[model samples]
Target: MSGRIVVGVDGSEPALKALKWAAAQAALTGDSLEVVTSWEYPASWSTMMPGVPTEFDPEQLAKEILNASLEKALDPATAAAARRTVVGGNPAQALVDTAKGATLLVVGDRGYSGFKAAVLGSVSTNVTQHAPCPVVVVRGESAAS
Candidate 1:
């Protein structure tokens, strides 16, 4: 309400929905929207198979995902108005850090089953507990389809 709204997107269906929801909220509240995506190298990257391509750029991939998500989630004007950020770190932590001064932090429900979620941990759950601002876990289908 008083500050910007931050949303985390990962190019997933639910993440696209979250972006749409956050954009709508930002419009209603007259707040700026900041869209964020993060990338991190895998733990096994240093010991990967020989056939694996070494040309993969996680940061570039993240940027592409963010741009594509914005285009898919919002209208051209809205997408242009929204701020885009690509970070390098854990998804949940990157979101929390970027949302430090935000009025709200929005994320999607990845739809991980209860048992799987407990074992793997959910980014939405982690950010809801750790973010400095109020968090919204948008749960729904993608608007694109």
Candidate 2:
């Protein structure tokens, strides 16, 4: 392995931390850095309420989120140096597939703010269990701590 350093980001604080850490690691190891983000088609096509946003563009949204994550998390030079990929699929699967030939796969220990106890089945967990390369998970401190 030790080819590329792959990181999965979804714009969360923990994810941003992972991205920054991965970029640093890549610089130290002289490995290429690849940041990945995944998106899926909307699950529901139900009529949208007036205030709800219904214009769906999964690819575009994924790219924006990924870029924003990098820009917000890493220094400008670091963010610009890291290659980004926005793919359409399950986040876990996409990350795993993208990191297939990578030396290390990095992801956040936490994700989506929608649920309180959804950490176990998240992208980090899935990638840790199934990624072809070694995985590193970065977790943010609890707010209550």
Candidate 3:
């Protein structure tokens, strides 16, 4: 049955790979693509040094990252065809929630941070365990090649 294919994009190389993979899969399955990104204030934000300008907008940054990731991952027509969402919360939880009722959920093996030898990022690991639908964690070029 045709449904949404949700993918998390964080402006990282691995995320870009996952986006591309998800787009191709959606094309084959006739599923619509939903590109998602999330943002949350740092725990230390409230405790930052006094006089530090606190004009940062995590949600806006998340939107920008999602837009850039879509451009890098898909052609203009394909990117425009996909739905984009920017949420405010933990990345893993956002992805899992967005994947509900979706045909599949796609993520990168790793995100912005993690040990070089780690097989999967925290978000990818969490979503795989909790997502309501099937999950695809695309590995880096090494694994793809």
Candidate 4:
């Protein structure tokens, strides 16, 4: 069977870096690239009160974020040769689940973070530990240097 490469994207700079690397790798290996993004509503946002429907829909938000991130990460030429996917759930869980059938899973070392001290983000670290396939964590440009 042909190889499949999956990359998790969230529109962050590190994610963009991962996407670029994944795209190039996919092109070189003739593997299909699947770009994935996960979105979830914060507990605080959903706990506004009883009887109030959560205005936030995780699936819809994920789709929007994935579309925007894909547009920014892949150029016309590169994207034309790849497939895109967006899933809704915890980023780590989503990535691990997607990796179940993938040849490799790629992710940024760090994603949208509230603190600079955080390393590899939670999702990246989790995937590296439990992914079904090989996992590649692309560090930030500064870290790469």
Error of 3 at 66 (Å): 0.4
| lDDT tens digits, residue span 10-76, model 3 | 9999999999999999999999999999998867886864565678677888989999999888999
Question: How accurate locally is residue 54 in candidate 3, as Cα lDDT from 0 to 100?
Answer: 76
Per-residue C-alpha lDDT of model 1 across residues 1-145, encoded as one tens digit per residue:
2569999999887789999999999999999999999999878885864566789788998999999999988999999999999999999999999999899999987733344324223788899889999999887543353
| Maximum-TM-score candidate | 3
RMSD of each: 3.9, 2.4, 2.2, 3.1
Candidate 4 per-residue lDDT, tens place, 21-129, comes to 9998988888899988877666776465466565746677677777777778789877766677777678899989987889899999988787657776888889999
Identify the superior model by TM-score, candidate 1 or candidate 4: 1
Please give the CA lDDT of all the candidate structures: 0.87, 0.84, 0.92, 0.84
**Candidate 3 error regions (>4 Å):** 46-52, 143-145
Lowest lDDT block of 10, candidate 3: 45-54
Best by lDDT: 3
Q: What's the distance in Å from true for residue 128, model 4? A: 0.5
Ranking, TM-score, top scorer first: 3, 2, 1, 4
- TM-score-wise, the better of 2 and 4 is 2
How would you encode candidate 2's per-residue C-alpha lDDT over 58-84 as one tens digit per residue? 689889999999889888988888898
Better of 2 and 3 by TM-score: 3
